[model samples]
Every structure is written in structure tokens, then in C-alpha cells.
Target chain A: MIHNLPPGLIMILGALLLPLLGQRLSAWGALVLSSLSLFAFWTTPDFHTVTLNLFGQDLSIVRIDRWSWIFGLVFHLAAITASIYALHVKDTKQHVAGMIYAGSAIAACCAGDLITLFVCWELTAVSSVFLIWANGTETAYRSGMRYLIIQVTSGVLLLSGAIIHFQQTGSLVFENFLGLEPGQRGAISDLGFGPLLILIAFGIKGAFPLLHNWLQDSYPNGTATGTVFLSAFTTKLAIYSLARGFAGLEELIWIGCAMTLFPIVFAVIENDLRRVLAYSLNNQLGFMVVGIGIGTELALNGTAAHAFCHIIYKSLLFMSMGAVLVRVGTTKATELGGLHKSMPFTTVFCMIGGGAIAGFPLLSGFVSKSMIISAAGHEQMFAVWIVLLIASAGVMEHSGIKIPFFAFFAHDSGKRVKEAPWNMLTAMAIASFCCIAIGVYYQPLYDMLPFETHYEPYTAAHVIMQLQLLLFAALAFVFLMKANLYPAEIRSTNLDTDWVYRRLLPRLFAYIGKLVRLVDSLFRVACLAMIKRFLNWLSKSCSAQGWLGSTWSTSSMAFWAAVLLGVFLILYYL
Target chain B: MKTKDDNSKGGNSSSDASWLERNVNVVIAGLVIACIGSLIAQLWWAPLFAEKHVEASHVEASHDDGTHDETSHDEHAHGESSHDGASHLHPAEFAVEEVFGFEAMFGFAAFVAVVFLGTGLRLVIMRDEDYYDS
Candidate 1:
């Protein structure tokens, strides 16, 4: 019966009990719930729908299929690993918020209808903000608020899009929008405005191009352990939504292309190593998006597989950086270097993550990412293929080279710190093992994909070509570094698109406030002057010294009354 | 060997220096050899596998159904060819995949372009940490 419950509810309900439990018990409970969810995911029959009748409309609260199953599995895995990483954290609120956040993402993944999905979607936005707040810094608080507003806006769009779609189609069963037929001219032209709104909603969460600043802004500012959880879920869930709703939509190819290319530039010069990884995370998502855009069996398989591997490795990267943040009190590349000497285990783990992300010959990225690139080549998308190739090298530069090189192996910053805690190292080790296991023996991963593909990743040609690209990219890094052409990390903030909201709008509001205050004071001054003049006239004419205020008031009153009466008589006669 | 106490004192111990300091040449040499070996293998061995894979994939495509058969013998045979020049033959495939050494060049060029362009953008957008504070 417990297994029969919606998988996400187990975590959500379990989170409610977290505060009452001891710290150790809460951590263990979080892991247990996540593992139970994974078990539920496996046992739940494919395409099995659990429906409830509400207001004469059927709502599918849980739908287990290969697509949702993959996402559910990864979400649980993220929850477990992130929970393990955060085991040392004294903050119970973060544990509760994290569990709830992970639960909401899993719920959204399994929801069979748009309404259920919308509810879970908003829940994710509401719950995840606490992770940001857990940092207890003023900057974190502000960033968390901005993150909430954007996430809620995304949920609103999803709700509106769902309503309009249901009205038009007379159904709310969640599936790919019928208008998103393969090889369509454009998503907007084909689906009209309704699905476009939904797409933009996912795009905002997905960190698509200009809608991406929320990720870079808030992710780094979360509590050290909190960011590992933050890194895994939100964008990946959005990717799942896009895969579910808009696969094979050709426009996504270009959008995904842009996503891959733009982040590299920002990540290159970013001083905060966590922010660099955040940008790297964006670049990684691009490959999945492109796969969804292509929408072939192989491409979809690539997307699912890449998402799985990316969750582990990206979190591992985050975990290592988090360890650095915990021990050294900073994650800035400008401040961190030669950390590997003190934190050798973390160094090895970071390298594994970096290698996995860079698509080295025996890593998860090689097995997964090549599928998307190969899919592009097979589709004759030469332009996208070229951009992807370039982005691959770009990935090597930032995630592969810059992250480890700067944090652990570059100039010795001379700040010796203890190795990461056992729990953190253990979590990183598990993730590192996964990165290698999935890379070398990929059959298990392939079996779990949404589609059956016989695509072989480790071809002699593929391996050699990938090696050539990665090694050559490495060479370029060395050349640049030796020549001093590489950008030096500095303690500064780079203005991103968030500047529009965080800086420009607030300053504009302040300027308007000043103008309004000036006008208000002027109006007050004029009104006071008129009152003063009126008082002066009163004193001059009607005060004790004036004629009206003199002792002859009775005679004047009589005279005025007589004159008024005479005038009234004359007018009446006329 | 340095004791744990020495590490905890947060002194600028020489041990904190990167592994690259002592082994930079060996690492660089090893990487160079790996790159050259990849180039050699790509030219010498990969083409033969590529041809076999192309032919094998062609056969598989003819009998292709929607469902993937994991135990299919031909699929395993095709797996040896690597990722490039596989069965989902499109007319306008990447020309670089057919040529040897082009990927390395392209990768190097891409790295340069990305770094150069990124550096240019940095000049425009880079600001002090308190840019928003004022």
C-alpha cells in the first residue's frame, strides 16, 4: 500500500516529520524516503495512470511511463546524494525544504495531467527558496526573493497556458502539444500563443538565453550544502517538461544552440567558481535541449541519458566546491588555489567530475553527449553540429580545465584547510564512482533510456575524435596560461542580465521617488503661503484694530441688514 | 613527511603547491603523446572500422523497426566502428567527420575564438563587486 502511494508524496509527507526527528534521524529518513521513491518508480507499471474525478473532470495524479520514470529515478538519486552531502548540516529547515523541493519536482515529473503538474510546479518554486534563505546573508535573502518571483511567474504562465489549452482541446491529459508536430516551421507559428506561453514558462525555468540570470544569481548564494540540492532539480525538471511537451520542435535546436554558446563566455571570466559551475550547468543543459529538439529515438535517448549523468557529475562538482566553501570560507577562484594538497580526496573527486563533464574517453559525458552530437550529424544539422562541437571545446575550457585548475591546482593560495568531512567526501565518492561506472559500462544506462537505441558511443572514430578535440582544447588552455592570455580571476561581480531588475529598475524607482518628493514639498509650500496671506487679511480687516472689529459693530450690522432688505425689495419689484 | 599539525597551522607549506609543479613536463609530454596517438589512430585504424560500420548500419536500417533489439548481432558488430560514420546515414553529414586531423584544428580554433570573444565581453560587463550597492 505504501508502494501504491504517489512516489512524491512519500518524500513530501516524510519532510513534514523532519523537524521532529533528530538531525541524524532526519538525514537517514531523507535518504530512506528517496530510496523508497526510487523503488516505487521501478515497481509502478509503465503507462499506469491513477485518476481522480474532480468537478466532473478526470485528473491523473500519477502516471508512470518510461519518460517520467527516468526523471523520477534521477530526482530520487539527487535527493539521496544531496541528502548525504548535507548530513553534517545543523539546519533542519534546509533539510525540510530540500526534501519538499525534491518531492515537488518528482511530483511534477509523475503528474499525468496539466493541473496536477501546475500545482507541483509551483510547490517546487515555493519550497526551494528556503535553501537560498538558509544562507542567512542579506544578499542571499534578496537573491532568494528574486528567484521566488521568477519561479512563481513561470508557474503562472504554466497555469494560464494549461487553462487555455484545456478550453481549446477539451482535454487536460498531459502529453506533447498536438500542435508541436515534427519539422514544424516554428513552435510559435504552429502552436499559437497558448503552448508558446507554456514553452516560455519552461524556458524561464530551463534558463533559456535571456531568461537565465536567476540561476547564476541565486544558485551561488545558497548555503554551501544547499546548492548541491539546488543544482540538481529545477532546471532538469524543466528539461523533462520540455522533452515531454515539445520534443522534435525544430526551433528548440536554435534555442538550444544559443544556450550552449552564450554561457561559455560568462563562465570563462566568472570569479566565483560556483557561478562558473552554474554557467557550466547551463551549457550542459544545452546538449539535452538540442537532443529534445532533434526528437529522434537516439536524440531522446541522449537527452535522458545526459540528464542522468549530468545530475550526478554536476552535483559532484557542486559538492566539491561546497567542501571548499565549507572549509576555506570562500569559493572564489581568485582566492582558491593549490587546495588539492590539503584536500586531495576532494581534488580527485573534482577531477572525476571535470572529466565526466568534459566528455573524456572513459567518462559519462563521452557516452551520453556524443549521442546528441551524433544525432545532430545524422540529421545533417551541420550548423548545429559545428556549434555543438565548439561548445564541447568550450566545456573543456571552463568545467574541465578552469574549475579544477583554478580551485585545486593553479597558483598556491597558501590557505591550508582540512579535508572535507567524511559524509561530504563519501557523497562525492559515490557520485564519482557513478561517473566512472556509467562511462565505462554504459549498458545499464542505455537500458534505462526512453527509447531503444543501438547507438554505440565508444567507437574508435568517436573516441579518437573526442580525444583530439579535448586534448587540443587542453593544449590551448596551457598555451594561453603560459602566455598569460587567459583571463585572471578577480574579486568582482560581472553584470549579467539580472542587472535590469536588480539594479536598473530599483534605481529608476528611487529617482522617481525623489521627483515626487520635490513636487510634494512645492505643493505644501504654496498651500502654506496661501493660508498665511488669508490670515494676514483676517488680522488687517477683522481683528481688534480693524474697522469691523471696532466698538461700532451693532450700528454696522443694522445698516447692513437695512441695505440688504432695501436691495431685496427693489429686485422683487423689478 | 609533514605531520597533520603542520597542515592545520595554515602555513604556506611547499606541499600545497600543485602536482604540476614537479611533473609539468611529464604531464605535458604525456598529453602531447596522447594527442598525437589519437591523430595516428584516427588516420590508420578508425577508417577501416568506419567503413565496416557504415555497411553494417546500412543493413540494420533496411530491417529497422521502431523497437530496439539489444541482442541484435549486427548492432554489436556496428558498435566497433565508434560514433562517427554510423548507420543513420544523412545526405549532408559533417564533412569533418570524414577527414582526419580536422577536429583537432577546429577544436583549437574554437578554443581561441571563445577565449578571445569571452575576454572582449568581459571588458564590457565586468564591474566591481558592489556595483549594485551604490
Candidate 2:
């Protein structure tokens, strides 16, 4: 029975009991529930499907396979770490949100049918917003509302796509929509209307470029520890779904490249360190999208590996930023500097995350990102390879140096606060450890990939090229700083795609409303003028001075009437 | 650049700057050396790349003989491998990747270009801290 239980249901159902433990023990309760669920998930047999017969249709409510297993395991790890991160938060709502959010994401990845995936997708959307709203500020409330609308809209699209797919194909099984197998390539032409909508749904959730502003708008607004939970699940869930459903779509390559390139520039000028990380997260997803587009065994492995490592290091990065937010009360680069003096441990963890993300030799990024770049190189995609190279240096600039330098070192703002709370430190340390361990020894991660591959990441050619790329990028930073060419960290709002909805769309509606009111007032005045003219004529005629109102007018009226009668009689005689 | 001295006069427990703050030059020097070291490494590994290219077509096509093979290369691509003389993908596909200081130069140039672009972008997108609020 335990083996049959859905992998993430334990934590989802167990979240209700968390409040019973009271706020103090709820974090620990969350940790225990996730651990138990992980154990249950690990023991479930391969290719297992737990189904329910409802309305004469069999729904694969739970399925454990290679793809889902990797995601499931990582989701559990993230949940446990985030629970540790939030251990000190006495707010029961945050813990509940984190658990249900993490659980639904796990369940979403394991869902075997589109219907099951849709339910869990919406669940993740609904449950995760509380993490933002738990901040209990007006800005947080607004950002959370935006987040909820976009996410639920994506879920709605997913459901609508599934319904259409069911009507056309008579199957809701969540597999490749394009019917392409490993080593096969496909184009957007291969997709039907149903799958196309589903792809957009995935694209939105994955934060594909223009669809990405909700992430930057909402993630930074989440409460300190809450952002840690927010970082791990939702977007990665989209990556999993895309890999399962839309891998090998040709347009994804260009889309992924665009996704990778634009964000790094934005990250360069972003003030909020968390928002910078959010942009960095978007850039990393681009690499995975490119891999899925490649649609080869080795490329797929790279995607899986990159996702695993990214989850850990990203959580680590966010945890460090969260610690800064906790102590300094802001993550704005203009307001933060010299934090390492007081928070040495967080500084170290942040640097580790920075280095790993930069794809330093032996780090998790070097191991995983190289695979995708190499996959492109192997395909003889010279342009794609070169773009990936530029993006690597770009990653070095933002996550590697700018993040660590501005937040922890740079010029000291001299806010020497105490170290991060013990639980927070513990969580960051765990994530940091995972980053280093995976970088140095990656066979375990490789073993978890969906396919067998002898594709190596540590060849001398690969390492030297990667090192050359990152080191030179760092060298460039040093030169820029010495020359005072690096843009000074200024407190400013950087407008991105969110401006369309937040500013342009609202202003457009207001203008339309103003136009409607103007027309209404003009129309009312026109009608009133005509009415007043008629009334004026009636009032004048009624007065003694007007022809119809005067008593002598009766004689003239009788004469006119007689003339009319005589003309009528003449006409009748003729 | 605000020196460590400028920061020494703020808050409790920050009377003296840390070793890193006082030695910014050392970090720069270290980065330069590491960059040079990476360049030297490409030179050292150029010969290994040579041998890999000669045997790349067969070794990478289907199996690994343990001498740097990508065994999982797409089988479908084999039919189209007429030009590169290799059935599987290798790290050094283009002659540009094999240049001695190509990655180093590209990294430096790319970094500068992105930073400058970001500065230019700031002119267009950057706004007051309360731009949205007001």
C-alpha cells in the first residue's frame, strides 16, 4: 500500500496536519513528511503506474519512470532543504504553502496522464502563491496576485489543450506530442493545435523570455525563507513537462538561445540580487531548452543533469540572498556591501554557488553545461556553439562575479549584522555541499539520467576551454572595475516585459475609458441642445408676442383653413 | 572603486578591513595568472585533441574504447556526416574552437561587450527606485 501511494501525496496530505504540530514543530514535521515520501518514492518499481477507473476512463494518477524519478528525487531533496531553511519561521502558513507547493510539483512531474498533470499543475500554482503572500505587504500581495493569475492561466491552457488532445487522438497519455523518438528531430509543423497550446503553456511556465516577467516580479517579493522554496519547483516542473512532451521541436533551439542571451544583460544591471538570480535562472533554463531541442540521448542526459545541479546550486544562491535579506532587510546591490565581515559562512556559500554557476572546472555547472555546449559542438552547430560560449562568459559576469562581488564584497555598506540564523545557515550549507560534491563526482547524477551515455565532461579539451572562458571573463571584470567602466550599482527599477501589462495595458484601458466618457458627454450635449431649441420655440409661441399665441392669430388661422378647404373642394370637383 | 579604508569606519565589528578587502590587487593578479594558466593548458592539450580528431569518426560512432569517446552520439546523424569526415559529434567541430587563445579572447571580448550593452540598456530601461509605485 505504501509502495502504491503517489510519491508526493504524502506531503500534500500531511500538510494539513502540520498546524496540529503548532508553528514550532511544523518545520520539523515537514522535513519528516518529505523524507518519508522520498523513501516511498524510491522503493516504487520502475515503469509502475497507479491508475484509477473513473467515468470509464483510466487515469494514470501516479507513474514512476526514469524521467519522473530524477525530478521526484530532486524535488524531495529541495523540500527537505527548504524545510530546514524555514525552520525558524513561526508562521504556519508559510510552512503549509511550501510543503503543498513542493509536493504538487513533485506530483506534477510524476503524473502519467495530461489530466493528472493539469490537476497537480494548478495545485502547485495555487499553493505556491501563499509563499509570496505570506510576506503580508501590499507589494507582496500585488506581486502574488500577478503570479497567481499567470500561473492559473497556464494551468487553464494546459487543461484546454488536454481536452482538445483527448477529443482528437483519444488518448491523454503525457508523452511526446510530436511522436518523435530519441535521435529524431521535429519542427513546429509537426505539432497540432492542441499540442501547440500545450507548448505555449509549458513555455509560459518555463519562463520563456517574454513570458518570464512574473518570475522576476514575484520571486524577489517573497519572504526571506519563502523564496528558497519558490526557487526549486515550479519552473523545473515545466522543464520536466517540456522534455517529456515537446523535445526535439526545432523552434525551441532559437527560442532557447534568445532565452539564454537576453537575461544575462538584464542581470548585469539589476539592483535586487534576488531578481538578478531570477534572471540568471531564466538563462540557465535556456541551456536546458536547447538540449531538449537537440533531442539526442546525450543532449537529454545533459538536460537531466543540468536540471539536477541547477536546483541545488540555485537554491543555495537564493538561500544566501535570503540570509542577506533577513539581516540587511534588502538585497539591493546599491544598499549592500561588505556583508562577509559579519556573515562569513554565507559569503563562502554564496561564492561556492557563484563559482558553480559560472561553470568553473569541476563544479556542477562545468560538468552539466558543458554537455549541452558540447552537444551543440558535436552537431556542428557552429553558431549555436559560439552563442553558448558567449552565454557562458555572460553567466560568469552575472552569477559568478557580480552576485558575489556586489552583495558580499565590493565597497562595504558596513552593515555588520549577525550571521544568518542557524537553520538558514544549515540549509545553505547543505545545498553548498551538494554543489561541490556533484561537481567533483558526477557519476551518481549521470546514473540517474534517462539514457546510458559514454559522453564525458572532464576531457582535457573540455576543461581547458571552460577554464579559459571563465577565467578570462573574470579578468575582464577586474579590468573594468579598475577603469571605472563597470556600471555603478544604482537603486533603480529595470523595466522588462512586465511593463506591458503593468503600465502599458492599464494606461491603454484608462485612455479608452476617457475616450468613452468624452463621446458620451458630447452626445448628451447634442441631444440637450436640440431639446432646448424646440422648448424655446414653444415658450415664445405661447407668449403674447408670438404669432400662434396672439389672439389675432385666430382670424388668420380661420382664413388659412378656408383657403385650404376651397382648394380641396376644387380638386374634388375636377 | 571605494577602497577598504573607506569602509573601515562603519558599524560595529568593522574597524579593520578583511584580508580580501585590503588586497584587491591580489585577486586581480590571481585572475590574470589563472587566465594565463588556462591558455597554457590549451597548448598542452592541443596534441590530445589532434589524436581525438583522427580517430573521432569511428570511436565516437558507436562505442568507446576508453580514449575520450562520445558513445551516445545520434545514430541518425551518421547518414549526414559526409562533410566532417566524422559520424559522431566531437568537442572540436570547427577550426575556430581549436585556436590557441580563442576561448580566452572570446570570453574577454564577450564580457566587455555584454557590460557595455547593459550600460546602454540602462539608458533605456533604468528608472527611479519608485518608478512603479508613483
User: What are the runs in model 2 whose C-alpha is more than 4 Å off?
Assistant: A551-563, A570-574, B1-15, B50-92
Docking class of 2: acceptable
All candidates: DockQ = 0.30, 0.42
TM-score of each: 0.87, 0.94
- On residues A192-270, what C-alpha lDDT tens digit does candidate 1 reach at each position? 5678899999999999999999999999999998999999999999999998899888888889999999999999999
Can you write out model 2's per-residue Cα lDDT over A115-188, one digit (the tens) per residue?
99999999999999999999999999999999999999999999999999999999999999999887688999
Give the 10-residue window scoring lowest on summed lDDT in candidate 1 chain A.
A179-188
Q: TM-score for chain A of every candidate model?
A: 0.90, 0.97
RMSD of every prediction: 6.2, 3.6
Most accurate candidate by TM-score = 2
- CA lDDT of each prediction against the hidden true structure: 0.84, 0.87
Question: Pairs clashing in candidate 2?
Answer: none
